[model samples]
Target: MGYNTFHTEGDMEVEVEVEEADQSASSGMAKQAVVENVALANALVKDGGYSWTSPSSLKLYPIIMLITLNTAMNGYDGSLMSSMNAMPAFHDYFNVGKQGPATGLLFAIYTVGQLIGSLFAAPAADRLGRRFGMCSGAFFIVIGTIIQATSKDIGQFMGGRFLIGFGVTVGCTSGPIYVVEVSPPSMRGLFGGLYYSFGYCAGALVASWTCYGTGKMLGDWSWRIPVIIQAFPAAIIFCTVWLLPESPRWQIANGQREKARSFFVEYHGNGNEDSAIVNLQMEEIERETNYDKELANNRWWDYRPLFSTRDRCFRMYLLILVGVFNKFVGGAVISYYLPVILDNIGIKSANEQLLINALNVVFSSVASVFGCFYVDKFGRRNLYLWGALLTGLCYIPMNVIAALAEGHVAKGTGYAFVAFIYLYGIFFSFCWMPLQTLYPAEILPNDIRAQGFAFQELMNGLASFINTYATPIALQRIGWRTYTIFLVLHFIYLGMLWWSIVETKGRSLEELEEIFSDPHPVKKSLEKHKIVLATGQGVKRKPSSNVNDDGFGNGCLNPRNKESLEKHKIVLATGQQSKWE
Candidate 1:
């Protein structure tokens, strides 16, 4: 029999079919089976009525705002300690001398804490749920900040800073993933960018204000006050996240379809003309079901496929390379060392250095805002390539000035460096910051998205850890030469950006699976051989409907029949040949 079709308010329709059978026993049973199939399909396709009246009507925006707030606190806690280091109380309490190891050690401990936090965030979020993971991290921050506030010695203060770093690490890892999952396809980049942009802005504001207000309060409580202030935000986030919905993707993966549906409707609204939320629950159910079926026998260890073959191996390597290099390319070093760098260049007074640092924050925050506006429009790769280029160019003059000058070079050099720093901040806010935040959320498949991002964060934390401690030592040993090192590193980053990085600007989470499935060869010899076959056949063949040319040379593997499903297993398993055409 032919399939029957029913129309909905939009052009969308549900197609159904029921096969007729003969009166014979076998045929009768077949007929009944067809009837059952028809019934189930009908139910799946039925119009549930518009639950989402308008995009603006959904409560999701408020929830997104909350996540942004939490993210801001993370940024603040992560960078605040850097600015505080210039305070007399912190310098005295820590026994920090100009460009001393103790100074590096104090700041480095926080990154070490972040490393530990990143290692645990994924499994915790997966097993205990996102809310629990977030709250647990927040709790850690509160305790850490409290200790930091009360610490009398450098060791105690280091311990507290580590704790705050650990907590904020969790927020950094989980917050973007959570936000990306809940957002609509069209608004994903905008909302996701907002989280990082606002977070960085708030962080800059905190560091600036804290330094400006308490620069002279060199008593025991001076630096402690900022550390203590972090607790309030943590406390608020800890309590508020409890009321938010667990990720619908996570719920569906755990086989809670009805609950996922309710969440999608309540927060996202039902798929109605007036509602902005299109109920993707049914689509997700089907997609996840297919994914589960495809990987039914797979185990957690199957993640080996991520690095099994040459192509898969290359992709993983590229991701790690970019992540690790991104950190070392002087973002963390600049962030942690900006005040000292300024002071060395003869800004003289601590207050002047603090003011310049504050200006850095303001300019970077503004760049972040502009980045949010154009990220989706310009695409990730465009921003990254140009941003790295501009940032690299900005570093050149600073390095030259430092290398040549005996004292403050010239007033003009200082002006040039200051101008370059703000431009660098803008470039960072627009390109590196948002791109780094968006990459982990968009590059990996659903099953491994959290795990992959955690690993990315681990790399970031490790880099930061090394930079935090090693920066002062490097500066001490190299003196003005440190700028030369960063300048070289930025060029390397520019090369990587032009070569391997893929554009994932406005794609959905489902769409990202396809984007990263195949490797993009940067080397000339391998580029020609990297063509993916549609049906595993060696001969050149027509591209399948599931494969889309993503404007990159390689084909993007669309998740045909699998994008909507919630499966716990990684999408690709070792020993299973890739099915992309």
Candidate 2:
């Protein structure tokens, strides 16, 4: 076959050529990180590089915004519930008499709902398409909100909260996958991470201020209004999801080639079906998916690869650690216990507590917006390493000041502690909030992304449950020492990250698969990342001059070995060849 040279109207031409050669090297050779990176790079980028301001990017931005907006349900539910725990009317109406632990239990039960939702999130996303998965989740949230708004007893209140938790988990988990799968390589960090930053934080911001306003209302409406308001975000997602396109990657994997092609043309290439960019992406998806089927047999239960070898197992731990540390890193403690903490420190006014909560989330939301713009620019390793380091440092002075003013409230120390609290939120917004959702999505392969992401959600739920349930009790007992536990844990987390996690900036989703496949992915990744960042180009393999090209000229970018392609074809043909066999 001859090389195909495809070009867009305002873009440069890209040539894809095929040639025949001896397949000895690739025949017995296993797929590794460096080789995979080369193949993936060939698939994602065209000769004419697509930037953030291109026509395709402009067309795709609004669609990405819609998907990301689903995360608001998560943010709104969390902040609203945290604020409600501080409401005096809420305690009286729900009969939650003077027990602090009882409020903590309510929070813990909500996490249980999240646990249940996460259990089913993987199957739903894999069985149904991404669009339908999100819609199903939003529907659940709407039902849960309705149940909560009219509940008169603790049982009904908890049932409603559980349902909201379940629904939000599904939507939140699905939102990141959709953004990551659909985003262009250059814009992946910004668009893939925008949901956690803009959607979730925006939801929290609205909830915080909404609870403050509703607290002034006379009766049940004080708490019931915010509960009812929770339905709107889920409702918006449910209504609009059917109108959007399915993930192009998902479409290709499920064997919907023509449909996938049309989507890439319309949504990604702005209707330029012949665009070299579209052709390259489609080729990459088909080849990589075919290769994955050969490697893992396309079965969901084959989780052995995740923990079979040292490198793979290490990567799994890193993913789980991200989910765990994100919750336990002191932000959740401060978020749910802020009003209580403030009261103990002499800011005892209920109105002042609500106002502080409102301002904290509002400022945190602004920081998230800023984070979205800078995440790609900063790289994942730097963002996590520095963000964790800086935020952890802020806690030392904060704890010292709180201890100094423990019994008799010093206004200056109290205000100093408040500033530190806000500063902590600012650092967390920049570091964890955006990455919590983005990191796992980037690290996991497409074959196991659904399952891996689900696992992380499970970890996140458990961690959140413990922090929510235990933070109140811990603060009641140790006071400022509650801050000390996280201070130590933060450094431990930073050390683990430094030793293990690799930078995944300026690389496509497919390129990440190669990084994980390498035996020494952490080191190999650092080397590959440097090349991509320095040149704004993907890592390229050294060209062999000895290969003969029968169908394409010397200038054509051809696959080196025809025998390797034949071997790959044979491997694909062996449908159920399990490693265990």
Candidate 3:
């Protein structure tokens, strides 16, 4: 049977017509038929119905690696400039000394640019296609980096930074969605972790090395050198993007099923073995059409639907808490203002300050490596809880040292303060960084994933904007006591994580929608579709059907109830060739 002749009749059976090939080709045709049947069978079975399997091709990994590198450039641009801001020659050349508000303005304006980019560019990823949106983002980064390298004054420098932030906003917004769409379920968490881990590590490394080298060089070009080096990664990612295949899921969602199937074949390998894999993917895609329908009907302008219902509202509230608290616990303020903070603590030598910053980056890199291996095993909520607690604990001693160092503490306490801060970075890597990246992807339904993430980033950028300026003002007023304020915020964030966040360890995207949805409407909707399948009845039962009112007094499930009316999915994996027509 050729691929085109097969069709499904309801859920019961599939019909295929076997045709004889040329005399020399008959054996090849028989082999192809057998291959298709096995592939189809493996593809159809979900959960324990089929044996476990791995991805058929290695191409998927490189695509993920490139996206990770792309995301890392965002971190590099955001953090590297912070250390440069402290350079003496650069400070005099830009006329920023004694002008605290101007420094704050520079940071705030860049964030404002990022806010605009994330809010606008994210949705286009879904609308225009991932490939086009990502390529455009890379182009912006290259332009922004060039502007920064050539800036003649502070105003020009800020302008360049703003453009860089704008470009990075696309990377932060689209990178997660792209990685999630391309990865298989089993390895999703690991791949996603690698993206953030590498990005953060890159940011830290750039900050450390740039600060050290620029301080030693003792010239105006010291800072310019680091800013210019950023262009290298931007160029490499742009060139490599042409080699990546479009995300198969995105293609499928866009109604390019033939293209998606062909992509799977090209990547998965050519053999009788691949037919089952192709059919299975097709089934999964078929199951997700309703998700696409919901997304299509969503209003782009009004974000109220995200928080309109009980469960969704709860999820929205959780997302907001995570977004704000993640930045508020002092990670952004510390990272962006580390050199200044070190200066205030009596580490006057620029070389010492740069070395300390490098040490902090090293600790964070180690933590990220640990997190990549164990995030799935430990689960999301557990890590958040522990990360928050440890981070809060680390802050207490540092705050105490800061308070006492002014009067009674010895000079060596500066070393203690720096050590505690590095420990804080380690905890942040294991807990907050991973969860910030992981939770946003896990909590939202596919239709709203991009928008939900955009909102999260908006809040994060807003918090960071406040912190960027607020840290300097706080330091001017409180000296070292600012660490105490962070201590209190970390505890507050810990409580929120323990009480509100839900576990989403192994759930598929559809199952996640049901698990997090209001059970009542979901139950009512699923009941209507109960007759669609017999074998998968048990599968349906696993999804929670209870609906509850959103705490804000709105129903979480839409009263329209369109999902229940959808047809049951037909599972068709290939097996040994049969004589029946």
Tens-digit lDDT track of model 2 for 1-581: 34343232224322222233123223322121121123223333332345455677777878887786678888888789778877889988877732268878887888899899988787678778788779888999999999999998988989998998888788777788988888766567777668788988988988999999998888899999999999997898899988888888888878898998888777666576665447656765776788767666455545565665554576679887778876777888778778777877778677888888899998888887888777766778888888889889998887787677678987666777889999999998977778878888888777677777877788888988999988888887788888888888888888988887887875666655555565667765565210010012222222332212211111112312122211111110011111110
Error of 2 at 518 (Å): 1.7
- Cα lDDT listed for each candidate: 0.62, 0.70, 0.62
| lDDT value, residue 144 of candidate 2 | 94
Stretches of candidate 3 above 4 Å error? 1-57, 264-281, 407-409, 518-581
By lDDT rank, best first, the candidates go: 2, 3, 1
- Candidate 1 lDDT score at position 337: 80
Give model 2's TM-score versus the native structure. Answer: 0.84
lDDT string for model 3 (1-581, tens) is 34222222112122222334322223322211111122222233222122123244355667777787667776676567666666777777887742266777877777877787877665667676666566767777788888888999877887887877777777667777777766555455677787788765776587567767776786778888888878777677677776777777777777888787877665543322345444545555556565557546445666766775677777778788878767778776668777766666667676777777777887888888688766756667778889899989988888887777763555588888888898998988877676666678777766667777778878777877888777777877777777778888889888877777676654334445544554443233222111111122111111123222110001112322334322212122133221111
How many clashes in each structure? 15, 0, 20
Quote the RMSD, in angstroms, for model 2.
Answer: 9.3
The sequence of per-residue lDDT tens digits that candidate 1 reaches over residues 1-581 is 55443332323222223234323213111221111111111222233212234543357878887877667776776557657756766777767864668887777788788888887877766666677777888889899988888887878888988888888878766788888777755456777888778766886688578866877675876776777777876798788998998887777776777777777665544434322223333464447456745644234334464554454455566668667887776777667787777666666577777777778888888878778867766666778788788888888877877676556466667666778778888888877676656665766656665666777777778887777788889877888787788889888888877878766643446544443443432321111111111111111222222332211111222343322211111011111222222
TM-score of candidate 3 versus the correct structure, residues matched by position = 0.78
lDDT of 2: 0.70
